[model samples]
Target: MSYLIYFAIIILIPIYAQMKVRSAYKKYSEVPSSTGMTGAQVARQILDEKGLYNVTVEETPGVLSDHYDPRSKTVRLSSNNFHGHSLAGTAVAAHEVGHAIQDQEAYAFLRLRHTLVPVASIGSNFSWILIMIGIFAGMANLLLLGIIFMAAAVVFQIVTLPVEFNASSRAMDQVVSLGIIRNDEERETKKVLDAAALTYVAAAAVAVLELVRLVLMYTGMTRSDD
Candidate 1:
């Protein structure tokens, strides 16, 4: 039963979230925005209006691969979004710009997330190996270390939820305040952003579930050895 629950969280949830995002993107990507502005233009307008003059908006390859790189202060939009004047494009572009704005304002969660990146990366890379070795060797201390590492990754995932949701919120606000989309179009744009946000929620769920599974396994092993 525990394995089944773990499977659902690790497999089903992310798959469903990805399907939702792809479905929404496909549907709205074909629907042209009334503003008649390409996503690049929309992003640039928002950045400038927000006084993020140093942030560069660039066209990147791949579908739905758009993102904001705080290190370079660049908003990289997928090719379709950079050139297409579609609802999906507009929403995605604005969402990336929202991250740029968050970086400028020094959002607490975002800053903390950045600080955790190195620790989280290390934890993700080595936790599984350490846990497996500890289990095979019946070493409780080593297992505890692995759990601590996994906990770091889990904390990073939980922190990510608010960062993503906040970005979506900022995206909606910018698009509406800038008149990028009409009242009727606002709903469609929001649907796209909302779908994207679900992916992050699914990721956080997976992280939490995996951590729980590890803790349970560790406790069970200790109990059995007693």
Candidate 2:
């Protein structure tokens, strides 16, 4: 039952978070901000203020695909968020810009996460193959190696939590300080970022749960072998 519960949580939480974010974004996307700043404008102003003039803001093709590319010194905003003057658009754009600020400020966790990206990508990609081979061959050492790789991915996800939360915090602070949002708009803008943050929390939770499940499965296999 515990296993089933964990499985359900790993599966359901992300789905719920995604739905919540989409709903919130859709609701706020239609309501234009009183400041009349498009998301691109908000991001540009915030970047310039932060002395990140070298960081370019560009429109990316996709819904909710916005991100900051540290390698390129670019903030990529989704189509609607790039041009829309809505609270949701500005909020998301500001959030991505927050990442650029973090990169510039050398935010500890963000820097660490950036360093771990390639390693975690490799670990997550190959760990499943190692796990399957070990299980089929009754090799505990091989399975343990796979578990270690999965653990690396889990650590990456854990580090990501602080990086994401801090970015959202920075986004909220800058948006208010810059006068991009005010009064009721402040609260609504927060709702948009908070909804998006939940998705990151859900992703971390899923990774942790998966790591635990893998450990338990490996333990079961070893005990059966004994």
Candidate 3:
């Protein structure tokens, strides 16, 4: 059952995101945003309105390649969104901008997660080395260390859930508050953003399940370990 749930998420979450991705673009392809503003314009407005001028909005190449870079102070929207003026573009653009707000406020969860990123990266990489040493050396203690290190990757994923969800909430609220998207179109804006949020939720769940499975195998707790 556990493995099934994990596999289901692995397969289904991307499918859902792609479906919504297609639907969002299809729905907004004909009717542009009420303001007739491009995504770059909308992103700029949100940054300005929030008194966050330090952040720069840049047009990036590729489809569905939008993201906010806190370190670089840049908000990058994919070409489709950077130039397109549609419900899909607006929602995606606003979502990236939402991360900007989180940066401005120094949101506790975001700050904590950001601080842990370096540590998590180091732990995740070295964890497998420890697992290998443990297995090859036949040392129970070394094997245990490896599992613990590898598990840090899962914890990092777990911690990321709140950061992503909070950003989405901020994005949705800003979308409505800015009135950049029309009231009539708000539902679709929310729909697209909400669907995007689920992908993150699915990711966190998969990480957690992976951790459990790893724990079982590491301790000889499963039949697979022989």
Best by TM-score: 1
Q: By lDDT, is 1 or 2 better?
A: 1
Please rank every candidate by lDDT, starting with the best.
1, 2, 3
What lDDT does each candidate get?
0.94, 0.92, 0.80
Instruction: Give the per-residue lDDT of model 2 (tens digit) for 36-104.
Output: 999999999999989999999999999999999999999999999999999999899999999999999
| lDDT (10s digit) by residue, model 3, range 160-219 | 788888877887788788888767898878777777776677667766665676576666
For residue 137, give model 1's deviation from the true position in Å: 2.3
TM-score of 3: 0.84
Clashing pairs in 2: none
Candidate 2 lDDT: 0.92
Question: Of 1 and 2, which scores higher on TM-score?
Answer: 1
Best of the candidates, lDDT? 1
Clashes of 2: 0
TM-scores of all candidate predictions against the true structure: 0.97, 0.95, 0.84
